[model samples]
Target: MTAPATSSGIPVSRIDPYTDASILDPYHDYRALRDAGPVVRLDQYDLWAVARYDEVYEALHDHEAFLSGEGVGITEQLNKAQHGSSLTSDPPYHDTVRGLVSRHLTPKALREFHTYIQDWADRLVDELVERGEFDAVTDFGQAFPLALVPDLLGWPVDEGRERLLDWAAAGFNAFGPLNDRTRAGFPLLAEMGAFLHRMSVPGNLRPGSWGAELVADAQAGKIADELLPALLGDFLAPSMDTSVSALSSMLWLLGSHPGQWELLRQDHGLISNAFNEIVRLESPLRGFTRLLARDRSLGGADLAAGSRVLLLYGSANRDERHWKSPAEFDITRSNAAEHLGFGHGIHGCVGQALSRLEGHSLLNALLSKVRRIEVGEPVWRLHNTIRGIESLPVVLRA
Candidate 1:
């Protein structure tokens, strides 16, 4: 890759982050991005990237300067398409929309699912432990959320459960530039969006469920009718893969480092900490784009108005400037929770509590049934914005 300078004099790298190779293992490129400068211009995408923790964290919080309303993707077209989705809206508006969506997933609201999710995880782990081998992603990681999210939202098992995982993956893929991966998913995403819109009706949702609440809110004018579909999409789209990838990465981290797994098995309480560490080490949603709302100077570069800035969460979490030995996955690390793996600020992951509940519950269940988790070659699924193990071969010691 060649290093060139943009017209504004920001250091440029020819690395295309959306490419398959980069998505597979982005650390090398991440290190290069941070080392080159705080703001590295990606000539391939014509966007400036903020890879260091300081800048990324600042940009995440400073929604005024780095706006999400234009869309949080590399391509301008996605910004146009996803204009007012909770993920794409700015504050005031973002706060209102997010509040309406978050009412159902709040800690108190999700507490009911703790036992159910734990029971599900335990049952799944019991089967894996009995068999002695299983694919972690299919059998455990993705399986947990793929089954739970739709049910929690009260979608009909036959209608929505089967398609939840694919729709979530495709939704995230559309966040990137118009690459082959994004291109292939566009049609699927469109179809899924239409389905979600149609099924978002009150009668289609289970009574007293999250989906029902959202539909009721729309009917009562808590949020506009037009925004209901996007809000419901918000509840579904980002939840699946983000949790799947996080859980899968957590399993991979634990299985690969037997000592950590042993630590988790012994304490059980550290399951939450372990989840944080895993995401800190392998952030699921790699990075998101922010349009420069105004011309501003950051890290010695003068960013012009309307320019796209990539906030590298994966890079930021592993940045040496923020953490000591940032690359090492240490579950007991004191400040691991401070990582930007789930992002930072007001726009930080609203569903984080639910994700933690699912991960922690599953880990707790595994500790009770399995003594050791032996992992084989893990297969990575490449999406522009999400990093996940598609298949994780593992043998559990009962």
Candidate 2:
């Protein structure tokens, strides 16, 4: 994977991460980027590719230097479109907007839903086990979250419920460069934005629910009325597709590695570490770009101010420099939680506690109900930013 060097000696590659071929099987290109250098210049997008663990971690932590306010997407238009959302903003404003939703997502606040989530998981597992075969992605992965998140956010049972997955996936796609995949997402995103606007109004959201709280906040002049829709989306999108991706990947990994399944079954306590390990191996989000706020040297590559750099969280999790035998999946790996699968620092995923609860509940239910997991080949979905399975034939044996 020899790359041409710029006059500044930065290794350069024309690899387009958003290409259909690359999105389907990105690990090869990710490995190539990592091998080429710590910070390789992606000639195709004119963005710096930070694929190694150390560099990606540093960039995520130094939010001031590697700014998110400039927009994290690869395109200027999309970034501008996402201007007011928490995902694309930096501190003071970022902290204020994120705080409105953060209180509800914290571990302590979410404890009330523990039994509820567990019961749902058990019920879903029982149905899947009874059938003995089903598509893990649609049946279990997408099903679990779709059932839980909407009701939790107080979404109406009748309006636009079916399109959440598609909308959330498209929202992530808009983060990539202007290409067919990214261009195709704009319309869906517009539709989602419209739904969110309707959902954000008072009397539309169920009172006392997270969505309603945002409405109340807007009404009280805590957050602007226009920001309500984007804020609702911030809570909604991240809560769905990413969890679906991780949950589906969990089943695939456990089914493919029976020994790991047995290991998990034996000690049920390993469930938490196992979730971390799963995301470590199959990061749901391929990566998100960060704009350099100032001229900075990242991994020996001097990037100028206003430059965009893509931080590959998926690549960083599997970086050889950080993990021993990085590709090998071991639930017992003590440091699995250290993986950047959920990212790190201030910009780390705000809804992660809820995600962990969802994963833990499902895994615990699986451990008690099924003895063996038989899975056929997975049909991988090609999206700009989300790396997930579209379908996987699975048969569970009790």
Candidate 3:
């Protein structure tokens, strides 16, 4: 099959990597890329975007064909000095580090944090119910999860929630072409990277926290000591942002559609499925990249080995090939569980269960106390990799 031609005359992705356009609203552009064809070469970054649903799933699933180690979000040359990490490597090296990561972040371990999770929810709801008004994104969605993750990781910071908020905004800046969006974030990225490196050191964590557990796992032959630092950075980097972003997106969905919210209020048991549907509606992030380990064919396109392909996760969830009337956000929709919001395959998100649990606990708490989430004029954050609303003003009529 012939290679998918790039939209040469019209730049495929002109949005600045560091600007609000990508962060504020990417749906229109994502639609453009998807409708253009299965694979569109981004003129700005000179990268390929796998826009169709089938192609993206194939890209992420065919690990043998698509390698992830060369760096997905950030270019290889930018981070070539980096050794290996679970996220950046393909197995068996990725498998090795990921095994250790999965151990600490596995289902059983997250269940152990259930007590802490419940406490965080109760505290946030308590604080917000008193005032009866707040920006759910920052006050709770963002603020609450941000507080939970760093505490569990034992990150060394007096104001970790605030600092991480800034750092996360700046962290996902290089997914596209370099522009003011990405260039302005270079300083923050460097500072955060250095700070994170220091925090990943064994000395930086409390003895009982997961960071220390990872250190011990390395000491006990679970993973290499050298890789442990990068592994720890993985947790700190994605944990708060993804979950919090998702939570914010969920609030946006629930608040905007009162009927669905009412349906959820009546059947509080559907909280789990509700979270999945929200992801189906507005995924936390659009895509992730995988390097082609070798030549492989997918979605009628024969991709060459070593080619970098973006797994358009957001597109996949909405793919007509997958879900019925995929565009509509139906909380009670059957088969909603099949969507790969957290991703699929061995490289799928390790902290997903933790994120899901947080989602359930927060949603359940809201349903128990409030009738509906009334939101107005929500503002979305500007970032290249992540997709989420930043401001969701709501007034709970308790």
Candidate 4:
């Protein structure tokens, strides 16, 4: 590893964040990046990195300085691929499209599905408990959202729904730099696009579902017809993968740290805060890049216009400056909600409300039904962006 000095005086490291090794166990690299400085240039990727919590938070909130419209991915190809979508666009237009997608996801809007989601969670946990041992990732984490989100979004039940997880994971993989993993995802992304296009037609989607609403919006001349696929994707990909990562991590974390599980079980009120702690410790999306719109001073480093900087949510969540014992998983942490796992500011996750609902419902159900959560080692998934478990053998003692 070489450290190169730049005119801005920023420390440069040769760390490759997308490597299979790095993706599998990134905490050491995250610590190195944070310890280096507030801003460190990744000489390997020719990108700047903001690993400290203060800097990441500031940059995430200052959309004008750290532009998303140019693309949040590391490579130009991936960024251009996302052009015009809410993820890559600046406000006004970003606000319009996000509003349409978020209308159904708001806390008040989702209240109608409260009982339904809780009931589903109860049933799913009950089945898993009866089985005694099952793959927590597939049987529980993936199962919960896969069962509910598509139905709410109006995806046809028979249209290769089994592949939704693969498609969703691929969509996120495409956000990374052009590695083999990223390249493999393009075809899957296109397939998802094609599927969304087919479902965009008036009669193809469930009439009253969220997907149908987007289709109707496009038909009514409210949004461009071309944007329909991206709009539906805004709901589909993120609503699945990130939630699965959080849910699966929830189980792994609770199981490994029986003390935390007992703490949560004893105080049912800690359910919401526990979810926050889980994502804070293990952020699903590691980080995303932002193109500097203009030259600016960040953390005393002079960043130039057109420079692409990676705001590391995962690193920031574990930054020692902001978090006391940042590496420790304590559900009672007072400021746990401040973590940037779901992002911050305007581009903050649109589906976070629903994600929280799902997490809360599941935890509540588990508390009522299971006394102990025993687990085997987690088989972590290797991908460019999402940090998730592929499988975990688990036993739920009642």
The 0-to-1 C-alpha lDDT of every candidate, in the order given, reads 0.84, 0.89, 0.73, 0.89
Clashes of each: 0, 0, 8, 0
- Between which residue pairs do clashes occur in model 4? none
Model 1, residue 289: distance off in Å is 0.5
**Model 1 spans > 4 angstroms off:** none
> Taking the tens digit of each residue's C-alpha lDDT, what string does model 3 give over 1-398?
12445433222444322346554665555666666667666544555677667777767777877877777764666546445667778878887778766776787877877887877787777678778878878787777667777777777666344677667666565554455766787787777777766765667777788777887787788776677767876776567778888888887888889999999988988998999999777887667777777877776566677777777787778877667888788998898887777787877877788888888888877877777678898877666677787688887666
**Candidate 2 regions off by >4 Å?**
none
Measured on C-alpha atoms, candidate 1 has an lDDT of: 0.84
TM per candidate: 0.97, 0.98, 0.90, 0.98
lDDT, candidate 1, 70-176, per-residue tens: 88988887778886577899988998888887877788988877788888888988888888777878887877787778877888767867777888888888888
Q: List the residue pairs that clash in candidate 1.
A: none
Model 4 residue 218 lDDT score: 91
When superposed on Cα atoms, how far off is each prediction in RMSD? 1.4, 1.0, 3.3, 1.0
Query: Which lDDT tens digits does candidate 2 get at residues 265-293?
Result: 89998999999999999998888999988
Q: Which ten residues in a row have the lowest lDDT in candidate 1?
A: 1-10
Clashing pairs in 2: none
